[model samples]
Target: MNHRHLGRSGLMVSEIAYGNWLTHGSQVEKEAALACVRAALEEGITTFDTADVYAATRAEEVLGEALAGERRAGLEICTKVYWPTGPGPNDRGLSRKHVFESIHGSLRRLRTDYVDLYQAHRYDYATPLEETMLAFADLVRQGKALYVGVSEWRAEQIEAAAPLARELKIPFVSNQPQYSMLWRVIEDQVIPASERAGLGQIVWSPIAQGVLTGKYRTGQPLPVGSRAAHEDGARFIAKFLTDDLLGRVQQLQPIAQEAGLTMAQLAIAWVLQNRSVSAAIVGATRPEQVRENVKAAGVKLDDGLMRRIDEVLGEAVVRDPARTASPEKRP
Candidate 1:
C-alpha cells in the first residue's frame, strides 16, 4: 500500500487505512476480523484506525490481538476519544480528566505503550477547548500519544483550536471526517481551514456507507445482510438510500467500468484524488473486501474523469459547508 504524510507532520500512514469501526467486535466474528486484519497486513497496509467507543471498546481489543506480533515501529495505530465509553459522566467528552482517563483505557485495550495518533472524536460543546488541548499536550509530553487530531469538527472549531495547540506545542496533525462521492460537506470550508492550520484529512466512509458499491440497486430489496440491512449500520446509511440518490449512484456504473474499477474502488479513488486527503479508512467484514479496497490506494483519476463524475452525481452531492458539524450538546 502507498503511504502519505499526515498533514504537515512527518508521520506517514497507509493510503488506505484498515479500520474496524463496525465489524470487529459487533458485526463480524472474532476469527473473521482477524483474517481481515491479516489480509490488510499482507496487502502492505501499516496504518490501522479505531476508536475507544467503537463496539463499546471491543474493536480496539480485537485489533490489538490481531496485530499482537507485528513489528510495532512500522505500524501507525490511531484511536479517538469524546464519545460515551461508559455510563459515568466523566467517561465522555474531552475534558482534561476524561482525556487522560480515556488514553489510559485505550492503551490497555490496544496493548500499546503509545498510539501514533490520538484524536478527538467530536468537538465537545460541554468542555472548554483549553481543557481539551491542555490534556492532549500532556499526553504528548508523557509520550502516550505521538500526534493529536480531531474528527467531525467544523472549520471554525479547527481554526479556533489551531493556535492553542501551537501554543501548547502539540503536533495537531489530522482531521477525520466522513467523506465520499456523495458527501462533499468538508470540501468547501473544512478542507481550506485545515490546510491553513497544517492538518490533513483521514477520511472515513469513502464508499458512502457501502452505497457507492452499487450493491444496493434502486427499488431492489435491501441487499441481504448489507450495511443498510444491519441494525447497527442502517441509520447512518439511511439518508443515502433514497431512490433519487441510489439512481444517481447507479449512473456511476459506466464510469467505474470505463475506469476499470469496481464502484467501490472508484469511490475510494475519487476521495484520494484530493491532495489534502492523507488516507481513506475502510472497514470490512471479510478478507476479500480488505484486498479489494487496498487497490484504490495508489489509483489516480484524471481531471476529465473527475468532471464526468461531478456531472453524473450532480444534485446528489452534499456540499453545504454548514453540514460539517458536531452536536451542540455533548451526547
Candidate 2:
C-alpha cells in the first residue's frame, strides 16, 4: 500500500484505511469481522480507524482482538472521542474529564499503550474550546496519544481551533469528514480551511454508504442484504436512497467498465482523486470486499473520467458548505 503524509505533518498513513464503524460489533459476527481485518492486513493496509462510540464501545475490543498479534509499530491505530458511551452526563463531549477518561478506556480496550491518532468525533458546542484543546494537549504530553484531529468539524470551527492547537504545541494534523462522489460538502470550505491549518482529510463514506457501488437500482426494492435493508444501518444511508439519486448512480457503470474497475473500486478511486485527501476509510463485512476496495489506493482517474462522473452525477451531488454542520446538542 502506498502511504501519504497526513496534511503537512510528518506522519504517514496507508492510502486506503480499514475502518470498523458499523461492521465489527453490530452488523457482522465476530469471526466475520476478524476475517475482514485479516484481509486488510493481507492487502497491506496499515491504517485502522475506529471510534469509542462504535457499537457502544465493543468495536474497539473486537478490533483489538483482531489485531492482537501484529507489531504495533507498523500500524496506525486511530479512534475518536466526543460521543456518549455511557449514561452519565459527562460521558459524552470533549470536556477535560471525558477526554482524559475516554483515552484510558480506549487504550484498555484497544490493548495498546498509545494510539497514533485520537479525534474529536464531532465538535463540542457545550464545552469551552480551550478545555477540549487542553485535554488533547495533555494526551500528547502524557504519551497516550501521538496526534490529535477532529471529525465533521466545519471550516470556521477548524479555523478557530488551529491557532490554539499550535499555541498548545499539539500535533493537530487531520480532520475526518464524510466525503464521496455524491457528497461534495467538504470541497468548498473545509478543504481550503484545513489546507491552511495543515490538516489532511481522513474521509469516511467514500462510497456514499454503498450507493456508488451500483447495487441499489433506481426502480428495484432495497437489496435484501444491503445496508438499507437493516434497521440501524438504514438510517445512516437513508438520505441517498431516492430514486433520482439511484438513477444518477447507475450512470457510473459505463465509467467503471471503461476504467477496468469494479463500481466499488471506482467509487473509492473517485475520493482519492483529491490531493488533500490523505486516506479514504472503508468498512467491510467480508474479506473479499476489503480486497476489492483497496485496489483504488494507487489507481488514478483520468481527466475525462472525472468530468464524466461530474456530468453523470449532475444536480444529484451535494456541495453545500452549510451542510458541514455539527449538532447543537449531543445525541
Candidate 3:
C-alpha cells in the first residue's frame, strides 16, 4: 500500500499495483472487480496496470468503469498499446496510427482524458522504433499520457529506446516484465540494462501467475474456473504445472513457514527485496485475495531466506532462455 517512484521517472506509484490480465470479465465479474479495486485503494494501492490485449481489450474498459465511480485524481492508471486488435494489417504494433488509434480506443474505453502511464506492451519488430517512441513522446507532450514505458522488451531494445527518448525529451519511465520465483530472466539481462539506463522496474505476476501461491498441490487438478483453466495461454502453463514443479513449490513451504507467510506472500516479498524493483503488480478476483497479497508487503525476508529460495529453485534459472529455438516473449 506504500508509494514508490516508478523507475527513474518522477511519477510515484503504489508499490502494489492492481493489474487486470485474464481476470476481467472472465474469472472476475464487474461487481467483484470493482470490489477488488476499491479494496486495493483502501489498502493504499493507487496504480492500476492493464493492457490492450488483455481479455481482448475488455479489461481496460472494465477497469475504467470500476475506477470511474471514484474521483479521477485518486489513482495512477497504466495501460499498454500493442498486439493485434483486428484482422487488418495495421490493427497492431507501435505505429503512429496504432498509437493514436489505440489511445483513443483506450481513452474511450477507460473514460479518461489520459492515463498516468502509457506503455508499449512489447517490442514492435515491424514498426520503426523512431515512429513508436516519437508517437509515445508526443502523447506525453500533448498531456494525453503522463509517462511512457515498455514491457517485456529485450535489454538492447530498451537501451535503444532510452537514448531516443532522451533526444526527443521523452520521459521514458519503467519496464513491466514477468518477474517471480519461477522466472528470473529479467535479472540476467533486463535488470542490469535497466540500472544502466536509470529506468525503474515494475514486475508482473511476482507469484509466477499463481505458481508460487502454493494453492495447487501435486496430482491436484487445476481448480475449476481458474484463470489457467480458462485462458488459451494458460493451457501452455497447464503442461508445466506438473508434480515436479509442485514439488519444487513445496520445497519453499518451509522457507515461507519460517517467515510466517504463505508461499505466494514470500514469493512476492522476494521480488520487492531488490531495490531496482519499483513495484510488483498483483491482481485478484476478490477482495480477500487483495488482503492476502498485501500481507507480503509487510513480510521482510532476510538473506538466509533468499539463499534458501535460490537453493530450492536454482536449477530453474537459465542464463538466456530467449536464445533457445522457442523464444517466449511473455507468459
Tell me how candidate 3 scores on lDDT.
0.82
What is the C-alpha lDDT profile of model 2 across 125-219, one tens digit per residue?
Answer: 89999999999999999999999999999999999999999999999999999999999999999999999999999999999999999999877
Q: TM-score, each model? A: 0.99, 0.99, 0.94
Q: Following a full C-alpha superposition, what root-mean-square deviation does model 1 have from the true structure?
A: 1.0
- In terms of lDDT, the poorest run of 10 residues in model 2 is 322-331
Where model 1 places Cα greater than 4 Å from the true spot, the runs are: none
- Can you write out model 1's per-residue Cα lDDT over 1-331, one digit (the tens) per residue? 7999999999999999999998999999999999999999999999999999999999999999999999999999999999999999999999998999999999999999999999999999899999999999999999999999999999999999999999999999999999998999999899999999999999999999999998988768998878889999999999898898889889999999999999999999999999999999999999999999888988989999999999998998999988885878854
lDDT of 2: 0.95
User: Scored by Cα lDDT, where does model 1 land?
Assistant: 0.94
Clashing pairs in 1: none
